[model samples]
Structures are given as C-alpha cells and as structure tokens.
Target: MPNRRIFNSFFLGGFECSSHRRPDGRRLDLLSATGHDRMTDADYRQLSAHGMAAVRDGLRWHLIESAPGHYDWSSFLPMLRSAEALGTQVVWDLCHYGWPDHLDIWSKDFPDHFGRFAAAVARLVRDETGPQAFYCPVNEISYWAWAGAEVGRINPCAVGRAGELKRQLVRSAIAAIEAIRAEDPTARFITAEPLINVVSGSPEPQHIFDAEQYRLSQFEAVDLLTGRIEPGLGGRSDYLDVVGINFYPDNQWYLGGSTIPLGHHAYRPLSEMLEEVQARYGRPILIAETGAEGSARPAWLHYIGAEVRDARARGISVEGICLYPVLDYPGWENERLCQVGLLGEAEGWEKRSVCVRTASELRRQQALFEDVAAPEPATAAE
Candidate 1:
C-alpha cells in the first residue's frame, strides 16, 4: 500500500531522437553527422511552458559509441542541461530499440556492448547532473521483441522465436540496469512495457488458448523483471523498482467474426490494469504511455480520467498517466500516422492539410482533465 503521487505531463521520450525510427518511418534527427545537433534546449523550454514537470527522454548507447571505446558527449549534454534548467525530472530511456546500423541485434556481443554503453551514459549524466535522474534501461521490451523478432514489423524482423527474443531482451534489460546502478546506486528505475489485455469473441478452445498465450507473452518481460519467473533465465527482480505500463485502447481485441467498430475495442479500464500490476509486483505503477487517435480528445480524456479515478479509489499506487506523443508527427506506421496529438501538426510539416478543428478540441480536453481529483477511498465503517 505505497502512497503515490499523480505525475502530470505529456510523454515525450519517443519525440526525442535516440537512433530510433517513428511509426511514420522517420528516424530521429537528434544528432547530425557531426553529432552536434542533439535535442535542443528550446525543446525543453517549450515543454516546460506546457506545464510539464517530467519528461521521458532518451540517451542512446549507439550514438555515444559508434564504435567500441569511442565515447561522445557533445550531442547529449544539451539535453541534460536543458532538463536541469527547466526543473524537469527525466525518465531516461537507455535503449529504445536496436543499436546503431553498424551493430547487429542478434550478435553475441550485443548485451555486453550495451552494458558498457549504458554505464558510460549513467556515469556521464551522474557526474554532470547529479544522482536524481530516473532511468529506464530499455523501453517496451516485450513490444520490441514481439514486433521486431516475432511479428516482422521492424528491422531484423525475425519470426516464430518469441521466446528467444524475450530472453535476450530480459537479459539486456538486466545488464543495462546493472551497468547504470554501478555508476549511480540511488538512481530510480522504471521499466516501461506494453500491457496488452486481449479478449476473443469465440469461446472455442483454440481461440481461448491463443488469447491466453498472447496475454501471457505480453507479461513475459514483466514477470522476468519482477522476479516472478524461475531462476536461471536471468529473471531477477533486483532492479524492478517501478512497473511502467504503456496501455492503449487497441490493447483489447475481440476475436472471431464480430464486427465491433474500430473505436469500440473491448479494452480493460486502466484502473483494472493498475490494480493487477500492483497486486502482482507490489510496486508503484505508472501509465508510461496512453492516448487515443482522433480529434475527439475531450471524450478520450474523460474516459481515461474515469479509469484513473477508479484505480485511485482502490488504494492502488497509480503514479502517473502520460499522453503519448504530445505532438503529431508524419509517416507513422505505413505512412498512416493517425491524429493522436494534443496539438495538430504544423501546416508545412506534412502533405496532409492540418486539421484546424483539433485546436479547440485539444484545449477543451486538456482543461477538463487537467485538475481531475482522484476518487476518495471508501471508509471501513461504511
């Protein structure tokens, strides 16, 4: 029954470049050829103006070390300085996806390579910024493994080896955590992972089994991080301080021939997910990422607010809810980046005309949910 504080801010990790690509097929332009143009100071100032107290930003290992023992800090220093100046705490994501193009994902040296890289970043950030910075060794381990290794969605897209990918990801996370902690023992750790709750229309044995396996696969990383898995597989809970859940409305799915509307997916309320994670891991939970894709943001905000309220009433330590990609970008998944931004893209940014209608809607939704009070707990005497 740990007490939790509501963390208010828009999630901005993916927005910053860390040698990763957006859903729109755009790679982050954080660093230039000279590695001189990393995340600018103005970015932090703008985010702080939006009333942001925290930011999820990146510290890429590959960018720091294009080759072994070749460390570079010119690109990342500004990011750390900007966060400090803006008074914004950061959840530093070490590895968002794969390493630099030069390194292979499945190479045997990958884990140790990443470990050294992480240690270097942690030491640099700690020496320069002190020990208060938060760190997430890797972002969405399960999702990356499934999408990259099993589903063939991204680079090195291998298939049918979900277990192998999961194992490697878990080991990588553990190694990264160890490396960071070695430099800064008091650094806070939050492991962000997608929480997929799947539901099928068919009650047939095969369908039910598939649904269960899918859900189980989603939690594989969590189980390993939280020490719930059997030993000998690198499943140790020593570094799992916070369980970060990146949930989306599309997480729940109806199987079979059911014709549920695209927006009517049968997802579990965020509260339910919060409670389950707390019960299982006994750690504070943060909705590391969550948001809807559309102009009807008021309804989306209200729905998510209701879910958070429900969870707070149950004495769950629901720490925060971050709206993913506070701003829209172009070229998302298959060039179909849905309008999932609080603010629409600027006019010249993409070929599609900017949606002016989203401006008022975004303002209204932000106001509605800005100061939402968590539901009060029930009295035992009642």
Candidate 2:
C-alpha cells in the first residue's frame, strides 16, 4: 500500500501585508480586527487548536526594505514567534503581487534588489523558526504578471506587457529562491502559482490552440523554474522543488463558445489535474491554496478531499491541501472575503468548529488511501 502520509493535509491561514505606512501615515496592520490588539496571541492558539498545521503569512518587500538597506522586522517577528509557539509551521510568502514603490519594475536592478531582500528574510526566518519552516518566495507570479502588465488592473498597469513582466518576475523568483537556499541549503521552497484551466470555445482547432497557449503562459513560471523553458528563454532548475497549485472554482474558464458543463458552483476535479502536473513535473505537488465559497464549503471540501485520494491512488506525490483565507479579511476581489472562508461572518470565530459533511468525506477519503494498492506508473502515452 502507498504510505498514508501522502494524504495528510491541513489548512494554513493568514494573508499579505506590508509593514509600511498607509496613505494617512498610519502603519498598516495585516491582522484581522478581532486579531488587532494584544489578543493576537490567543487568536493564533485558537487557529492551531482548530487543525491548522500552518499559516500562509506574507512578508512584503516594501515593509522589509522601507529605505535602501534599512529594514524593520519588529512588527513581523511577533507573529512568527506566536506561530512557532503554537506548533504551526509558516509558509512565508515574500512577494504578493506588489513590490516596494521605490524600485522601478522595468529597471535592471529590480531582480538584484529583490534577491537581497529575500536573503535577509530567509536569514531571519531560519534564525527564528529553524530549518523546517517552508518559504514561498513569490505568491502568484503569473497572476501578478498577467494582471498588472497584461490586463492593467494594478499599479504601473500596462497592457500587452505580459511577456516583459513575466520574464522579470521569473528572474526575480529564481534569484530569491537561490538567495534563500544560499542561507539554508535545506530550506523548503514552494512557488504558489495560480492553476488556471482555460477551455476552448466551439471545440474548434484554433480555439483549442489558443486555450492551450493561454494555459502554457500560466505554466511558464513552473517551466522556467524547472529548467524546461523553450530555447529562447533561459531556465533555472535548481529552484523547482515543489509545484504549488492554487485553484479556485472561478479560476477555470471556457473561451470562445466552449462551455464548461460543470456549473458555476462546480470546481475542476483535482485528481486529473494533479496527475497532469505530476506527469509533467515529476516532483511532489501541494495544493498550496484551495477553498470553496463559504455556503458550499462542506460540499466543496468533500469533493476536493476525494480528488486528492484519487490522485494518491494513481501514485502521484500529492502532499497537502490548504483552505486559503481561513479567516475573513478585507479588500478581496469585489471586497468579498467572507464569501471564500470556511467560516461565515455571522458565525464569527465559531466558524472554525463548524464541521460540515465534507469533514466526514475527507476522513473517508483518508481511510481509502491508508490501505490502497500501489498505482501503476503513469506512461507518456497515457
């Protein structure tokens, strides 16, 4: 039987925040309101008691490097200390779709500057939390590139700059990973890229080709990190240890008249996608971020857990599943953080204990993998 450890997974809560000043000259606090005061310690312990193995916390570049060569780790240190004390590991995300405004994104110095900041953070985290803690150098590189450079939705928004921004970000990511590894060779790194599945419209060959191209663009970071880039672009293999897939129900799409038979509420099955990534990358994979809409979370969790079990039965090294945005926060897409968390606002902290049918399904799926037969090798032809 395949080992049962492969199916064990849990949620990691928390979000991004820069330790810089807000427009009104107020220092921004990333912790939720209920977590805002001296009570954050109690909140951290509460999260641990509710089965969170780790918390995906953000350490913004602007915050760390407020001025050239100047840093203030005072604010972030406490959170890390609390997490460690609670026995919850941290997946420290270095950059989350933004950077210090002082640095020009298109300048040659950007990558080198980012690398220095990353190395500093790695040293501090290792010194404080030890070697086993995980690090995500960049969060959603593809999405940030596409959104800021291609779609023009964020700062320095520019349309049709996807290619340029993607290259820059990939280089930055590699540099950061290399810097972190330099500090601690055993440092675990996971690059959390959005797993977007684009289906073609009309079932026409051209549409299919276009959709494939789109999908390839999203997978480019993984390709570059794994040293499988096309001949023209340079590739870096040393950084690609784990592929972190972040998928939401809304992350998939059908273009040009193609219909996803799966309802808007339905999510793409995890087993098939997990197999594809494993077949292509040949490395352990983690569902770095995945969660259902609050109202349907019970059903969503059940379906995802089953999919994970199925992937394991097929011999994929599926590591863990994280329920993202475990606590409600502000400033999400359309300002709807409550929609994604396992707990609804009305339930408050009680949402943590609110187990739905999905919990039972997850338990059942875990049981199935406990004694399953070894899966056949995934052949290229398959």
Q: Among these predicted structures, which one has the highest lDDT?
A: 2
lDDT of 2 by residue, 1-382 (tens): 1443322134445443423333333444444332422334555565555555556777656655768878888656877787777766677788776577678889988888899998888888889877645778877778777776887766447789987888888888878877887887777778788877777655579988998898667778788766687534456665676678987766777764443544454335668888888888877787888776656766766667778778877888876777775555554333334555543342343324434454454455545544532222221100
Overall lDDT per candidate, in order of appearance: 0.64, 0.65
- Can you tell me which runs of candidate 2 are displaced by over 4 Å? 4-11, 14-40, 230-234, 256-268, 343-382
Which lDDT tens digits does candidate 1 get at residues 1-382?
3433434342232343335554445555433411223333544555555555666777666567776678887657877887777666778778877476666768777777778888888888898888745778888888877777777675456788767777777777788888887887777788889976766677699998887787667777878765687567666766678778887666666554333343464656667777877888877677777767775544665666667667767887666666665445444254455566554433332222333454444445446444432322211100
> Candidate 1's error at 281, in angstroms?
1.1
TM-scores of the candidates in the order shown: 0.82, 0.83
**Ten-residue region with minimum lDDT total, candidate 1:** 373-382
Report the number of the highest-TM-score candidate: 2
* Model 2 TM-score (2 dp): 0.83
Pairs clashing in candidate 1? 23-332, 23-333, 24-331, 24-332, 201-255
